[model samples]
Target: MGCLSEESPSRSMKPFVFTWNGALALIVKVSIQPCVTLFSHPKEMASSSSSSSSSSDIGVILNELTCPVCSELYKEPTALPCGHSFCRVCIEKSWENREEDTGYVCLNCREIFAQKPKLKKNVIVANLVENMKLKEGKVWLEVEVQDTEHGDVNVKEAMKSGGSESFCELCNGEAAKRCVPCDILCCEKHLKPHQQKGHKLVDPGVKIEELRCIEHGKPILLYCKDDESLMCVTCTGGEHQDHKIVGVEIAHAELKDVLAAKYPHVSQSMQSVASQLRQVQKEEEKTENSSRDAEDSLEEKGRLVCQFVNESVDLMKSEINKRKMEKLSLLGKQREKLEQQMEDLRQRKSTMDTALQDLEAISFLQDSKDLLKRLETMSDFKSVKRTPLPVLDFSKEENNLDGLIMLNKNFLEKIQKGPVEHPEKVAEGPVEHPEKVELDQNNLRRLYGRSPSLDPNSAHRRIKISRDLRTATRTGTENQYRKHPDRFDDFLQVVSRDCFSSGRHYWEVDVRSSRRWVIGICSNSMGRKGVESGLGGNPESWCLFKGNNEFTAHHNSRATDLSLPGDPKRFGFFLDCEVGELTCFGDSRVLHVFWGNSMDPVKPAIGVYDGSVHFVHLVK
Candidate 1:
C-alpha cells in the first residue's frame, strides 16, 4: 500500500497505536490509517473520516490474530493439545531452548507432554488471520478512493459510503453481499457477476470467511472423520481423498445427537448422588439427636438418685436428733427429783445442829420440839430411797446406727461401682453331679431365702389365715376380720410380712392342695382395697396363675399363656432387685419371668380363690 503525504504542522495528528501488555511487542505499520488527508473539501474530508473508522475496525480484528510467542499475525500457526495456537517456528524454538526435564510444553499454557508431540495446523485461526489481512488491503483501497478531491460530490453517494461496513474485494466499495463459495465480500455490481458465475451469495453480515478453508480459501464442504478436521473440496481431492468423510452439516448434526442422548442419564446420575448425600446428612442429624437425648437422660437419672440418697440421710439424722432429745429430757427429770431430796435432807440436819448449840432453855426447848418434829419427819426420810441414776449407755443403738450407715454406704458404692464379687465364692469349683448341682444351687439361692409369712392384716375377709400365719385358705363363709387399711378387701390376695427392697431373695409356696391359685410378687405401693389391685390386674404386680387346668403369667392386665405339663406342686420365685427380674420356678422348670425396673420394695404374694396355699419353709 502507498500513501501520498504533504506535511502540515498545524493539521498534524498523532497516529494511534494499539498495544497489549505482557506479550511480545505487536507493531502494525499502517501509518495515517485513520487520519484525515489535506483534502480541504468538506465532502472529501467526511469520506476520509469514514475510511479511517473502517480501518480502525480492522485493527481490532488484527489484535485477535496476534500470537503470544511472536505477537504478529499467525504464520504457519500450529496448535498444541492445550488448544493454544502459536507460530510453528516460534513454538519449536521455545521448546528447544527449554530444560530437558520439562518435556515438550505449550508456550501459552505451559501444558506438558511426556514426549515430543506432533504439531497440528490450526485451520480456523489461519483462515481468520488471512481473511482479516485481505480485508485490511481493501480498507486501504477505500481510503485511497475517498482521498480523491471533488468540488461537488453527490450527497447520496457520500451518505451511502459513510458508516463501517465490509468493503468489496474487487472494487473496494462498501460490500452489499458476501460470496460463500469464494469467501469474498462483494458490492451490488460485483454480486451479480458472482451470482452469474454460480457462486453462492449471502447477506454481507454472515461470516462466510470463517467457514472457508485456510489451504484452499473455499467454503468447508466436508468433514474428514479420520483426521477430525473440516476440509474444502480441494482438500478432499488431495491427501484426504481416500479418508472417511461426510458433509460438514451431517457430521455436526450427528455429534449433536450423540451429546443429546447422553445428557439426561448424566443429569439423572448427578441428581441421584445429590439425593444420597442429603439422606446421609439426615441420618447424621438423627444420630446426633439420639446421642444427645441419651446423655440428657443419664444426667437426669443421676441427679434424681443423688437427691433421694440425700433426703434419706436427712430423715435419719432428724430421727436420731429426736431420740437424743427424749433421752436428755428423762435425765433432766431424774436430776430435778434427786435435788429436791438433797434439799430436804440438808434442812433436817440444820435443825438438829441448832438444837444442839442453843444455850437458852426456852429457845432450846422450842427448838427441840421443832427439831423433834423434824426428826420424826427425818425418820420418815430414811424410808425415802434416792432416785436411781439414768444410764447414759447407748451401745446397742450406736452399733445399730453404725451398721445402718455402713449398709447404706455399701449400697451406694455398689451402684456406682457395679455389683461386688466375693472372691472366695467365685473360687469354689462347680458341683459334678446334676443332682448335687441342683441341691447346691438351691442351697445357694436359699442363702437369701425369706420365710415369708402371710400377712393377716392383708388377708381378704373371705380368706382364713392359720394361727402360724403361714397358710391362707379361701372359704365360702366370710371371716369376722376387722376392716384394716392393709387388708385385701376386694380379692383373696395376701402379701408376705417381709418386703425385699435390695439384693436377691428366693421364696417358695406350697400350692399343691389348691385347685386354683395365684402366686407372684407385688410392690408395697400396690393398691390393697380396690378391685383393680387383684394379683396381676395392675402394673404394680405380676403373677403366675393356675385355674381350670390352664397356667398363665399376668402383668399389667396382660396375660401370657404358659405351657406347663402337670400340676406344679410348689412354685419358687427368685427376685433380683438390682437386676429387676422375677423368675418363677416350678418343681423342675421355670414357668415364666417378669421384669420391673422400679426401685420400690416388693413382697411375695399369694392369692387363693378355692383351696389353701402354705408358705414353704425353705431355709429350715
Candidate 2:
C-alpha cells in the first residue's frame, strides 16, 4: 500500500504494476528517487539517462495522483473507508442518482454501506501532486497507455515546473524554446536553425511528440481506413500506400458520435431480456404445481368410481343369496312333508305284519273284516306328490342393472367429450308423472290415436303373433320362435314394439274373440321370464283384465272391479305418460282407469289366456 520512495532503501526495488478497470498498464517505476518513474521509448530509452530520468520521475508522480473515475488526475483527492482514493467530484457524481436506502458502494472494491460517508481531502496525496508540478526543470505528465493492436501511445499533458529553466534534447543545458514539428528541445542559441525551416515552435515541456509517429519519427496527420491505424506522411507511402485515408480528427469525432447514439437501445434490449427470463422462471414453477394438482384429481375420481362398482357388486350378491335362501326353505318344507308320509306308510305295514303272525283261526277270523277294510283303505290312500322345482327369476334385476350400467356409461362418455355447449339441453332421464286428467271418450280414438304392433320376440312360446303383427293368439302348441333375451318364458303375453316416455297416445283392441284377456302398458324394464311378468301382476305394469265374467283394472296384484252396462268387444285405451294415467273405454264410456308414476318407457302390452285379440288401427 505504500508508494516507492528514497526512504525505503532496504527493500528490493521492483516495478509496482497494477490494473485500472480492464486496461492493464504500468503504473510505477523501480527506482530509489522520491518520485522516480520511467517510460519505454523504442528509440532512446537506454541512451537518455540523468535528465530523461528526472523527467520520467515527474510522470510517475502525476500518475499516482490520478483518479480511477474520469480517467483524470485527481482534483481534491479523497480517500474512502476502504483506503482506495478518488476525486471528491468524481465519487459524488457516481453516487448522485443512487437511492439513499441502498447506500454508497466503492467502485474499486465493491464494498457497500448503510449510509453515505463524509469525504475529506487526503493531505499526503495532495502534497505529492503539487510538489511534482513545482519541480525545478520543465516537466510533462507522461501517461503511457498500451493499446493491444497498436502498442503504446503517449497520452502526455504538458505542465510548467515553476521557472523558465529548460534543457535541449542533445545537451544537458538551459533551454529557451521547443519545436512542435521536429519534437526538439532547443536553447536560444540553436533555435534559429529550426526556425529557418518553418517548424512550429512552442514553450518548453510542451508534448508535441504525442501526435508523431514513433516508427517514422514524423507527425501523425492521417488515419488509415483499411488498417484502422494512425499514420504519418512516410507511412502512407509504405504498406498503407494503396489504402483509403482520412484526417485523424475526423475519424475520431465520427466514431464518438456513432457510439453515443447506439448505447441506449442496446442497454434497453439487455434489460428487456432479463425481465423475460424472470417471467419464464415463474411460469415453470406454476406448470409443475398444476401437473401435481391434475394427478391428485385423477386419483380421487378413480377411487370414487372403484368404490361405486364394488357396492353394486355387493348388492347383487346379497340379492342372489336372499333368493337362494327362499328357494332352499321351500324345498326343506317339501322334504319334511314327504318324510312324514313315508313314516305313516311304514307304521301301517308293521301292523299288518304283526297281525299275519297270529296262526289261530279264531284270532285271524276276528281281525279279517277290520284287516280287509284297512287293506282297501291302504289301496285307496294317496301319498303327497313331489312338487316341481321352483325357478328363481332374476330377469327383472338384470334388466334394472343393465339400465344402470348404460346410464353411467353414457354419463362418463359425455363428460369425457369436453365441456357442453348447451348444458340445459341435456336430459336427466324420464321425469315423474304429473297429476291425472280425464280425457273425452269422443277424442280417445280421434285426437291422440296410435297403432301399436305386437313384438313376436317378446311373445311366450305358446303365444303367437300373426304375420301382420297386429294380433296375438294363445295357442295350445308352442310356436317355433328363435330364443331371445326379451321373450316371455312363463306368461302368455306380448308387448308392442312402440313405446312412449312423455306424451299422450290412444289405441284400440278388438277383444270379441277372447273371453279372457289383458290389455294395457308395461314398463320397458319389466321382467320377461317370471310369473310376476303377467299383465298387472307387478308394479311395473298396468292393465284392464277380463276373466271369469268380470272386468277389472289390475296393478301390482291389486284389482279394482269395474261395472259396465254391457260388454263391448272393441276396447279403446288412452295413455297420458306425463300424468301416468291409462283409461280403458268400452261402449263409449270410461270402463276403468289405472294410475301411477313409478314407470317409464311404457309400451302397449296384451296377454290372452284363451282365444286371440286384434290390435285395431283407430287413427284416421
Candidate 3:
C-alpha cells in the first residue's frame, strides 16, 4: 500500500490501497522485479530473499492464500457459514464419516447445513495470485493503463471562422496544456495548481475543446456511483444530487467487491448443473453394461429350454414352432411396456425446460425448492409379474401312447404344478419401506388414494382452499365460503370429505410453511356451532397441536407435549377404525397414540393460524 499526497508532496497522508480476495486480503509490502513471479514455488524465493525481512513478507502472503485444513496453498477453496475456509477435498473427507441421523454439519460450530452444499472455486483469490506473477520491468503490468498524449496545443482567443484553435477554461486566453486529474485546459496560469494538487499525469487523449462537458461546460473530476457515469464537480450536486458520489479509486474498489461476491455463487450453480449432467451419463452407461450381462444370462436359459422342448415333441414339429413363437411374443410385450415408461420422462423434461425460461427471482427460487423435493421423492412404479410357460413331461404320455401316445395328460399335469416365479422390477429412483405398515403402503396408497380432499362447504369464512382442494390458507378477509352446519365459525378450520369410517387410514400434512397449526381427526359429532369450536376446544376432536414452537397431542381438551428431539415438516396420522386407536407420527417416528370413538364417520381436519397448510393423501 502507498500513501496519497495531500496539501503538499511532503505532507501527504498515507492512505493504504487494499484489495480483498475470497475471505482474506493480500497485502503486499514492496514492489518486485520483472523476473520475480509470485506463482513460482515458495521455496524458490526462500534462497533469493534469504534476509529476515523478505522471508517474513513471503510467510505472510503464503498464509493468506493457504487453507487451514491442509496447511498449504489452497486448491478449490470453499468458505463455510462459520467464516472458515477449507479445501474441498479436505472438507468432503470429513463429511464422509457423518452419521445419516444427524445430517452433514460443521465440525467446529456443529451447525447443520441443508444436505450437501455445493463446492465452489474461489476465483478472486486465484486471479489475484495469477496477476501477481505477470510483471514487466519494475511495474506490474495489469493495474496501469496508457493513453494517447496531446501536449502543448496552444489556444488564443475564441475560435476564428477560418482557423481551428481552442480557448482556455478559466480566461478565454491561450490553452497551453491539459491537466490529467481535473481534465481541464488552462492558459499556463491556472494549470500549475491542477498539477501541484496531485492531479494524475496522463495523456490528454483528446483536445481541450471536445473534453469539456456538454451540459456543465467544465472538466469532469468525479464519478456518480448511483448513475454509474462520469461528471464534473459543478454537476456533483446538480443533476447527480443525493447520489453516491466518489473518486475513481473508491468507485473501482466498490464495484469489484460486488462482482467478487456475486460471481462465485452464480458460477457454482452452473457448475453443479454440468456436474449432474456428467453423473447422469455415467449412470446410463452403467445400466447399459448391466443389461449386457442380463442378456447373456437369458440367452443361456433360452437355449436350455429350447433343447428340452425339441426332445419332448420331435414327431410333432409344428407344435414346437408354435411354442417358440409364444416365447418371442412375451419378450415383445416387455419391450413395449418399457418404451411407454421412457416416453413419460422425455415429455416431463421437455415441459420443464419451457417453464424455466424468463422467470423472475422469486419465481425461480420457489421453482428450485419444488424441484429439489421432486428429486428426493421416489418414482411411481407398478410391478408386472408374468406367469411362466407350462413345462410338459412326456413320460406319462409315452406309456399311454404305446410308441404313438398323446401328450394331453402330461401337459395338463404340468399346468397344474406349483406357483410360477416372476422377475422383480426395481423402480428408477430411491425406495422407502414402512416396516410397521400392515400392507404394502406405497402401492396401496396409489390405488386407494381416498379423495382426502378439502370439503368446500366445511371451510370457515376466513379459510381459503385452492382449486385443487389439497391446500388451505387462512386469509385476511372472509373468503365467502358457503355457510353450513359443518363449517366452524369460531376457528380457522377445514374438514376433509368426511368419508373415513372403518378399516385403516393414513394421510400426511405439509406444515413446513406454517409455524402454528392444529391438524388431526374430527368425528361426526365434533362441535361447529360457536366461535370456540377449535380443534382442541371440543371433545369430539383429537388433534396434534403446534403453537409458539411447542408441539402437543390433545383430546377432550387435554394437552400433552410431544417430546421429540427434532421438528419435522410433515406430520402423519394413522388411524385404525377397527381397534379404536389413532397414532400420530412426526418425521417418521410415532409421537403419541390416542383412543377415540370411531363408530361414526371420521374425517381428517386442519386449523391454520400463521400461514398455509397442504394435505397429502395416503391410501394405505
Q: Which candidate is the best by lDDT?
A: 2
Off by over 4 Å in 3: 1-327, 330-451, 617-620
The TM-score measured for candidate 3 stands at 0.31
**Residue 536 of candidate 2: its Cα lDDT?**
86
Candidate 1 runs further than 4 Å off: 1-441
Q: Which pairs clash (backbone N, Cα, C closer than 3 Å) in model 3?
A: 155-174, 401-405, 490-531
> Better model by TM-score, 1 or 3?
1
Candidate 2, poorest ten consecutive residues by summed lDDT: 24-33
Better of 1 and 2 by TM-score: 1
Task: Give one digit per residue, the lDDT tens place, for model 3 in 404-461.
Answer: 2122333244348733222112111111333343332332243233547898888888
Clashes of 3: 3
Candidate order by TM-score, decreasing, is 1, 3, 2
lDDT of 1 at 538: 86
* Cα shift from native, residue 26, model 3 (Å): 99
lDDT of 1 by residue, 31-132 (tens): 222222112234544544543323222323333355544344678888888776778886775555344445676644456799888899988667645533
